[model samples]
Target: MTTAPPISPRLLKGALIGVDLFNPLASIIVFQYNPDTMTRRLEPRSMTGADGDRGEAYRLSGAPKETITLSVEIDAADQLADVNPVAVASGVGPSLAALEMLLYPKSLAVIANAAIAAVGGIEILPTSGPMVLFVWGPSRVLPVRVGAMTITEDAFDTLLNPTRAKVELTLHVMSYNDLALTSPGNALFTVHQITKEVLATANIFNSAQNLGTALQL
Candidate 1:
C-alpha cells in the first residue's frame, strides 16, 4: 500500500508551512524542529479519610496534557524564501539582517499611545504580543502559548552582529478538554483523543494475536 504525505498545520492566515512553530504576522519561521521528545503529564487526585492508615486510592483528575521542548536554528544566513526580505538587505549580509528580523517577533514591544488605562473612554491601541503555533507532526497541530525561549548567539561577523542563533523553545500545549467545545483551543484536544483511542485499539489487537486465543482467559 502507498502512504500519503502528511499535511502541515494551516496558519491563522490560511497558509500552510512545514514548521514546528511560526507567527505569521511577526514573520518568525522555525524551519526544522529537533529532538522531538514529548512528555505526557497526568494529574492525580487522592481522597483522604478522617481515620485511615493511608489516604484513599488516587484517581486521574482529568485528561493528560503533553509538553515538548524543541531546539531550532535561526540564521540570517539561511536564504530560504520564507526569510523576511529586510533581513537580506543590500551591503549587510543576510545573516546579520536576519537576526534583526528574528528579535522583533519574540521581543515585547508596545504600540504608539497604548496606555494601560484609557481616559475619557478613548480607544487604546492593543499591544502586540508573540503569535506562536506548535505543530507536532500530522497527528497534533496546536495553537500554543510560548512558555520560555532562550536564544544562543553562537556566531557573529566582523561587525560583531550575531549572524546565527540557536533558539530553544519550551511550549505548553493548550488542551481543549478544559476549554469550551465551541472554542478553537479545543481542536488539538480533539486530535489527541482520536490518536489515543486508535492506539489503544491497535494495542489490544496486537496483544491478543501475539498471546493467541487458546492462551487467553
Candidate 2:
C-alpha cells in the first residue's frame, strides 16, 4: 500500500486594502508578511450622566472606539537570493513606498488645490485619500484609518535601498458614527457588529448547555 503525503494547512494572510472612495477598483496593497502579534484596545461610548441623568447610566452612545497596533516586517533577502530583478534593483524600497503613500495626499490633488487657491476659489475642501480596510480574517475585516506609523530600516543594500525593515502601525477603527450613512465603510461596520452579535449568541447557547449538564437539569 502506498502512503499519501499529508497536506499542509493553508493560512490566509492579513492585508490592508486601499480602495478609491470614488472608484472602488482603483488600487490595493497586500502586506508582504503577516505580523506576529497584534494589540487592540477598546473604549466604550457610555452615556452615563448628562446633566446628572442617572436613568441614562446604562445607555451607550454608539459602538466602542477601537484601536489596533501591529508591527509588519519587510525583508527582500529571499527574493534577492533568488535573483529576482525587481528585488535586485529596489531591495524593498517599492514596498516601503506603497505603505508610506497611504498616508499622503495625491500630488495631483495638491496641485489642483493650489491652482484653485491662486484663482481666488473660496473654501477648497480638504482632499480625502482612498478608503483603507484592515483585513485580519474573514470575520474581522474592519474599516480603519492610519493614525500613526514608525518605520525602522534594519538593513540596507549598497545602493542605499532598504533590505529589511519593521513598521509599527497604529490604526483607528471607523464606526458608523464616523462614516456617512450611505458610505461603504458604514455598511461594513454594521455587518461586522452583526457578526459579533451572532458569535456572542452562539457562545451563550454553548455555555447554557454546559451549565445544564453540570446541574443535571
Candidate 3:
C-alpha cells in the first residue's frame, strides 16, 4: 500500500520566496508575481444563550470561518517580449485572460444536470471541485474557496487589451474537519492535529515553568 504524502504548510511559510496560490482545476500558476503580503483571519461564531441563570454555551454559533486576503500582480511584459507558452496557448498575454482563468473557476455556476449525472454515476459528488490552495509551507497548504476578487487594470496594449493588473484576491478557507477523507484533506487534517498538540504541549510547559519559578521549586 502506498502511504499518502504528508501535507506540510510550515515549509512554505519559512521560504523567503513567499507563498503560492494555485488552482488545481485550471493548472495555471501565479508565481511570476508574488503578493506583497498575505493576511489570515478567523471569524468565530457569535455566542448566544438564554438570559439569567441559563449559562451561555461555549460553542460556535455556527461553523467558524477563515479568510485570507492578498494582492498579487500580473504583468505580461515577458510574455509579450518572448512569447510565453501559457500566453500563446491562452491566446492572450498575462492580462484579463490569465486572471479570468485563475479566478473564473471559483465562481463558475455548477451545471445542475451534469452534477446530477455525476452523482448517479459515481454514487457521490467529488469533494475537490475547483478548489484553490494557499501553499505557505509544509503543514500549511490550506484549501480555500475564492470569496472575492477585485481587478485593477493599470496598463493596456494599443488594441485596449490589458497588459498589467493588480488583483486583490480574498479566499475563504475550507475547514479541515469538514472535508472528505481524501488524500490532501486527510494529510492536512493530520497536520492540523499535530499543530494543536504542539500548541497544547507548549502552553503546558510554559505554565509549569512559571508555577515552578513562582514557588521557588
Best by the TM-score measure = 2
**Model 1 lDDT vs. the true structure?**
0.52
Task: For residues 1-217, write the lDDT of model 3, one tens digit per residue.
Answer: 9999989764222211111243333434434556668897887765764552335556555446778888877777778778766544442344455445544433323455466776775454433344456665565666666778798888777766667778787877666545676746446645765786798898998999899999995
Model 2: runs farther than 4 Å from truth?
21-27, 49-51, 212-217
Q: What's the CA RMSD of model 3 in angstroms?
A: 10.2
- lDDT of model 3 at residue 26? 42
Positional deviation of residue 188's Cα in model 3 after best superposition, in angstroms: 1.8
TM-score of each predicted structure versus truth: 0.58, 0.91, 0.59
Q: Weakest 10 consecutive residues, lDDT, candidate 3?
A: 11-20
Q: After superposition, how far is residue 28 of candidate 1 from its true place, in Å?
A: 5.0
Badly placed stretches (over 4 Å) of model 3 are 1-25, 46-56, 60-63, 81-129, 181-183, 186-190, 196-217
RMSD of each: 8.0, 2.3, 10.2
Q: How many clashing pairs in candidate 1?
A: 2
**Which clashing pairs does model 2 show?**
none
| lDDT (10s digit) by residue, model 1, range 91-178 | 1234223323433433333423433343343566553443335555566666555566677877665566665677666666556655
Model 1 deviation from native, Cα RMSD in Å: 8.0
Q: How many clashing pairs does model 2 include?
A: 0
Give residue 16's error in model 2 in angstroms. Answer: 0.4
- Residue 8 lDDT in model 2? 90
